[model samples]
Target: MTEASREVGVVLRRRPVDNPWIDHLWSPAMILDEVPATAPWTVLSTQADATIYYAGPASIELFSSDTANYRDNLADGEPRIWVALRRQDGGSELELTKVTVDPTEGEAMFESGCDVIGTVPMPPEIAAWIAAFVDEFHVERVFHKRKRDRAPGDRRGIPDEGKRRT
Candidate 1:
């Protein structure tokens, strides 16, 4: 199946936490529709409590099969783009893994063992892009109810020794 992709930049925040076990908390802060010229993992801002970093460019992929989910997402008052970050083995603390507009796929990311996953408000431009794709390729699927069996049947259709059907 043909798919659409958009290149965008992801911003992450590292915040000093009060927890005893962990030193800092990392999360996706926002997404830039246009990838900035700065290098990946570059620190953009630093504050007393939190620091923002450009996690680098990630692609938001769109499949025609998933346009239904995307449409549902846009219907919500606050559209969101889900970002997922994983902990690197030894190179970097965190790596930008995925950015998606499909809500079902986004929800599935929570089940992943990634270090950080979050939803950021969908930028107007990105939302419009998705809307246009959905409008062009979305196909409505009609649901049909299946008829139930007339009566309960034997397990595996096995014939009983005492009562066998001719």
Candidate 2:
């Protein structure tokens, strides 16, 4: 099957954790609420929401087009940034979380599990600010609830831990 056919109507899954590396990435985003009104995106299917950090440097990009309305057919209605998360296991089911681009706050809130994780996807120009935020603020510790397994096939066996052992 082609790449498009491989990703038909699929969603990623997410869990919560207090010591998420993403805390650094999303915090500054919240300060300015720098939500991209319009841009293209490349979805990196990973194991759970917390694993987003593993997507590596510059893994997060602007969404240039609507990604097949992955947000419960709400992509067209007040579009927001969407990320896919899945379990560590190679399951076929996942969760779709939306973060509203707060033009005022400079960050996006993870609406699904707002209490757990908030992410900020910003342009590269703001890289320096993001760095300072990390250096200035002490990373808070958090605990996230484990998500139940959905239908199989949503996960792609992507390791969330720092290293990928064979």
Candidate 3:
């Protein structure tokens, strides 16, 4: 467990949905502080609404540049860990793609339209771990707004406005 990275086990839930095109929906169910002896993709449990499977292990990577995002997450009343699962080609199996504590990186994962991305409550153990990293690496950035350089008369990018050039 180094300062820059931490490994955690993830379990995913496959809930049956009413949608005719899909059989089930995949989402991160929970994160485990301890790596379970259970095999990846092995069914852990089944309930009326969903079935849980071990989605294997993932690493939460921290960067000194990203400490601000981590701090914001810690300040959030309900801190969450972002999890992403990628499909195993055109099949039902899901691969645990990424796990992250930084909110900015987490939201960026959603830009990939094909992956199953979701957030799970940040485990207390993991939250403390991230908080420790932030305390050590967080650097306060002073925002310095820069004035745009432009000719005073130039209001638009167009060379000439309101008149057509014949």
Of candidate 3, the 10-residue stretch with the lowest lDDT total is 153-162
lDDT of 2 by residue, 1-166 (tens): 1111111121122345576453322211221224333222224344554322222111222121322222222223433333333323444322233332222221334333333343334333343333333344424446799987767755556556677667
TM-score of each: 0.87, 0.19, 0.85
What is the lDDT, from 0 to 100, of the residue 121 in candidate 3? 95
Clashes of 3: 0
Best model per lDDT:
1
Q: What ranking of all candidate models by TM-score puts the best one first?
A: 1, 3, 2
Candidate 3 per-residue lDDT over residues 1-166, each given as its tens digit: 2258777899989999999899889989899987888888889999999999988888888888888898899899889999987778868667787888888888999997546999999999988988888898788989999987898877676666568778
Error of 1 at 103 (Å): 0.5
How well does model 2 score by local distance difference test? 0.31
Which residue pairs clash within candidate 1? none
Query: Candidate 1: which stretches are off by over 4 Å?
Result: 90-92, 148-166
Q: Which stretches of candidate 3 lie over 4 Å from their true place?
A: 1-3, 150-166
How many angstroms is residue 152 displaced in model 2 relative to the true structure, after the best TM-score fit?
Answer: 65
| Candidate 3 global CA lDDT score | 0.86
Positional deviation of residue 88's Cα in model 3 after best superposition, in angstroms = 1.7
Q: Which lDDT values do the candidates have, in the order given?
A: 0.91, 0.31, 0.86
